[model samples]
Target: MATSPQTRKAIADSENALRDTLWTDAADRLWAHKTSGGFVTTPKTMPYVCRILDEMSKDHPLASTYEALWSYTWANNAFLRFNKPDDVTFAAGFSGQRGRRTLLERMRRLQLLGFIETQPNGNETFGFIFLPNPHAVLFRHQAGQGTPLPDPAPKGLSTHILPASWNAFVARALDLGCKDVKLLLNPPPPAPVSAAAPAVPAALTSPKVLRRRPKAAAKA
Candidate 1:
């Protein structure tokens, strides 16, 4: 997921700089310095990357978590696959040595959100479509600001996303006696063009047709 030209270059730069500061054979020495427990001498890397995963969870609350899950099934939600320090450092957006704490906090929060589902084998995954309809949980059982389900909108607030398309979906479901329906929120309207007035052509400017003011009087 973090595989890109920018990321690859960043990794190289980080490793080279680290090698210069730590030792010319720092990479080799570090690799060989593992303990009897099969742990790296510098074992802070896992927690650091986990923190990045956490931030991703916090950012979208549910949407991003769903994206994360769906990635395994479809796309790899921009999650950095490389756990190496240099590889992670090179990855933009996801890589932030400074943002480690924030990311961890978010991942913890997302787990509590019920958005992430644990598989039989204890695999953690998320998906875009709530195949069984997560909206049911939000509308009836569990719902709030931070959970997997979307928060309830204000009273009488109907959705407008693909009006015809959604209505068709609702119609199909309604026939099966489904009482509740949830839809994606529509984006805000574009700025309104001034229909009351005609647009002025840039070529026919007031300075060309009307009187112009002379330059301001200057002090002697």
Candidate 2:
């Protein structure tokens, strides 16, 4: 059932009151965009992306590769680009050959899963990394080109993700040079409505619900 306006307003007011009481200092926090090291822009529903990563590889572990990429990205640029002279060495965080090999393997896995695109330079395979919107990639994976989903495909992947989130993902993908127009905009169909589901009240769903003023308040 949809939330009543009074209940929603009460919850919001309570949360605001709590914030006003608890978070008294801004300096104590390490701001993402303003911080010295900078931060990565991730999807709102990032857990879905993490679950998808887990399905791709069990040995490498989910989010490890994802976390590594975020660590390597030090810029606060909107493009979400990551580059360095010795990117392999920097990304691996080790000078040894073993570390390089492990990083390389992880990079390949990410590439295969459509998370990143590598621009090779001479001997250095992953010299440049282009991070794609993971949510967009998730949508593509679900489409599956008429083939059966891989054993690792997350359950309820499409249904669980929101349409607004999908729109953001598509926009990001396009900005980052995604050429496949059809696939990016092609979202999975909405979930089938259940016959037993309760009907939502028109007042709750209408846009002007919050704008309506009480007759006494209007008179004043």
Candidate that scores best on lDDT: 2
Q: Evaluate model 2: give its TM-score.
A: 0.50
For model 2, the run of ten residues with the poorest summed lDDT: 154-163
User: Candidate 1, which segments miss by more than 4 Å at Cα?
Assistant: 1-62, 74-93, 98-104, 119-132, 141-220
lDDT of each: 0.37, 0.58
Off by over 4 Å in 2: 1-17, 26-32, 35-37, 74-97, 146-220
Q: How does residue 217 of candidate 1 score in lDDT?
A: 35
Per-residue lDDT tens digits for candidate 1, residues 1-220, read 2256787789889888977786876655554423533321211222322333333343333333333333333232323222232322232233455544433333334344443333222232321222223333223221234343245532222222233433444444444333344232223578988767777887668676545544573332
Residue 203, model 1: lDDT of 68
